[model samples]
Target: MFDIKKITVLGAGAMGNGIAQVSAQAGYQVIMQDITEEALQRGMATIRKSLDKMASKGKIAPEKVEETLSRINTAVDLEEAAKDADLVIEAVPEILDLKIEIYKRLDVVCKPEAIFGSNTSTLPITVLGAATKRPQQVCGIHFMNPVPVMPGVELIKGRLTSDEVMEVAVNYVKSIGREACLAVDYAGFIVSRLLDVVQNEACKLVMEGNAPEEIDKAMKLCANWPIGPCALMDLVGLDIVEHGLGTLENDLGPEYKAAPLLRQMVRAGELGRKTGRGFYEYNK
Candidate 1:
């Protein structure tokens, strides 16, 4: 296994910020990077809010919160943020080309031994690893959407990823209070494969005359899930849901085709909570 004490996270959106918070809370020196100063600041603010919540709930000591906050360094520079990082995680938007470009740049900038990981939920780790010089040191540590609240992390071992690298990643995630499950590099990792089917079927139900809230309630009560499928679709975003379905279809065959309703919502730019509309609407 490898040591991971310093981490660099690329992207300043919700997932990136949440991952940074969890890393900092685990006492790692975290370098959070975005393309612009404003974005970086926003991400840091999110981390601060999460820490404050922990402090208010007595989940962490005030001094510990202060210490965790201090361990984080936000920046707009990729090379600067990744310098000497023991682990670098890319949380950018889930476009294949964009992810490949970032990985190529990171392969050149990061130390030879540094472990590179992605938080991609559906993309294959092998495809992303193809962009790295030391693919053996690259893997996927797919955290759930609500990183701080989620208990599980999916550890994906690419074809080129070393066994030791996967072991190190498992240990690293465990250190941060997250359980890790190994998944094969594929169109949809285990969770996505199962969850997507559930979500898609729920959408079909809505298209067939069932109300959104009714579909959500039935699944909520029947499956004992924390939220209904529609609520989860809203939380995850129609854009993401659509993109994930496309990816799965391409990689797993027609059986994973994007549901018609999902495509229509995404085409209309109804991106769920962020857009204030999706299968449901958010009150402003």
Candidate 2:
């Protein structure tokens, strides 16, 4: 078992910053890496905003904000971010080739025995593991959207992932005050497979003349779902949902194909809250 003291999060995007925040809040030193200095600044700003909100709600002590911030560092260089990380959680965009390239670089930069965890909702961990020399150390640690607020994480085992890696993933999740549910390496795994299908159907409903708000309301009220699929898809990002659907369709079948409306929305570049537009618009 590798001793996990520091965590490196590749990408300073929405998911990446959230992962870094939670890791730091859990008392793990965190390094959030992106390709540009501006991106790193934006990520830090988001983290600060989230911590401030939590502190204001009394969810955490006011001083906890600074405490958490102190534990986090930002980097533009991959090697500088990952060189000392005992565990690295990658949260880059869902491009298979891009991820494979990163894993190869991380394999060279990260210390020996360091574990690689992917915050992927789609794609297979097995393929990612094959990109690196340390296949036994590659596992999926898929945190839900808005990682700091989500309590569930999918701890996925790749074909080459070892028991030690899975155990480490579980303990890391627990330490961060989240539950880690085990899943086999597969495109979309469990949560994404179920939720993506529902979200796709929600898109179909929209195309069939149901209003997005109405659809969400029905799911929330009638099905007791925490959030309606349309709203959830928006929160997850329309482009991300569409990408995951394409991945699912490739690995599964046409049944997993993204709804035409979803593809259209993605093409329009609406995305989600990040872009201030999606199923619903947000104030920038």
lDDT of 1 by residue, 117-179 (tens): 999989999999999888898999999878889999999999999999999999999999999
**In model 2, which regions exceed 4 Å deviation?**
268-284
Summarize candidate 2's per-residue lDDT along 68-182 as a digit string, tens digits. 9999998999998999999999999889999999999999988989999998888999999999999999999999878888889999999999998899899999999999999
Lowest lDDT block of 10, candidate 2: 231-240
- For each of the candidates, the C-alpha root-mean-square deviation to the true structure, in angstroms, is 1.3, 2.0
Residue 134 of model 2, lDDT score: 96
Candidate 1 whole-model C-alpha lDDT, 0 to 1: 0.89
Each candidate's lDDT (Cα)?
A: 0.89, 0.92
